[model samples]
Target: MIRAELPPYEGDTAHLRKMFSYFPSGVVALLANVGGTPKGMVASSFTVGVSMEPPLVSCAIRRQSSTWPELKGAHRIGISVFGEDQGEMARQISSKSIASRFEKIPLRHADSSALFIAQAPVWFECSFADELPAGDHTIALLEVHRGGADPELPPLVFYGSTFRQLQVSSADG
Candidate 1:
């Protein structure tokens, strides 16, 4: 079989964005305190458990993200794993409008360091450890401090261009 060569199409960044957005992903919110004020951004590229012995987790943050620098070296960072109900909150955090991100959203301080929100089904408070440059983003390695589970809620999946939830199965079947 012969493979066909594809022609290049030209457009703005939106074209590239729409192309990559096709991959479905889970939404997560990274929260940290900067100068006594809470700063957070929604992300979907968070990676999994790094070490089992020391209890560690990892995430990647773009070097160009405005909030990444402030979040780096934080004593504690809150990782809020969003449930399907938090789609609006995720969108708000992902938006460029910084002034209205936390508006109407309820957040609580946990362990005097990490900010925990009620909307998330699962979350973890991690202590800052080390980070190294990985391409255009920095791979942040964090030591787990505290975490909890909420299996009652379904995860919010980011697919194509929007957020979606898993369909529940009927018991009768």
Candidate 2:
């Protein structure tokens, strides 16, 4: 094995950050009912289609997050793939104040284990499968029991510390 010493450079943090920010990702709000109370947080690193045979999706969350403890107890998880209109809700859930989160959003009970919100472009009712710690955050792998999306709705995207709405190109235009 061979290793080379890298040269020191200024603004390395900004350069590294810009590199990661170039990769756009969809935002998801994960919710779980713990002791009949709903706990949720917005995450930008959620990815779909981990496995096709059994069907799986995963989300990465920091180990020290306050919401992760309560959410882990849920038998299943509610995954809301946000539409463009839900960006406000995403910010609310991402806020440090937990007491007021989800106070304004309408949630419905789904799978007897999670809460589903209306108007989400895509929704998933998934059973908690397992979690693996990777550096500062844990990767939670979920088995997708059921999921669906509205074709006409657009997705909520996050990039470079800002939220973006997905624009579809229509052939008729």
Among these predictions, the greatest TM-score belongs to 2
Error of 2 at 42 (Å): 0.8
Point out where model 2 deviates above 4 Å: 1-14
Question: What is the alpha-carbon lDDT for the whole of candidate 1?
Answer: 0.82
List, in order, the clash count of every candidate structure: 0, 0
Per residue, candidate 2 scores C-alpha lDDT tens digits across 13-53 of 78776777878999998888888788998989998889987
The C-alpha RMSD in Å for every predicted model, in order, reads 3.3, 4.1
Candidate 1 residue-pair clash tally: 0
TM-score of 1: 0.82
| Residue pairs in clash, model 1 | none
**Alpha carbon deviation, residue 22, candidate 2 (Å):** 1.7
lDDT of each: 0.82, 0.85
Q: What is the C-alpha local distance difference test score of candidate 2?
A: 0.85
Query: Which ranges in model 1 have alpha carbons more than 4 Å from their true place?
Result: 1-22, 171-173
Per-residue C-alpha lDDT of model 1 across residues 104-171, encoded as one tens digit per residue: 87887786568876768888898878888998888888888889878887789888888999777787
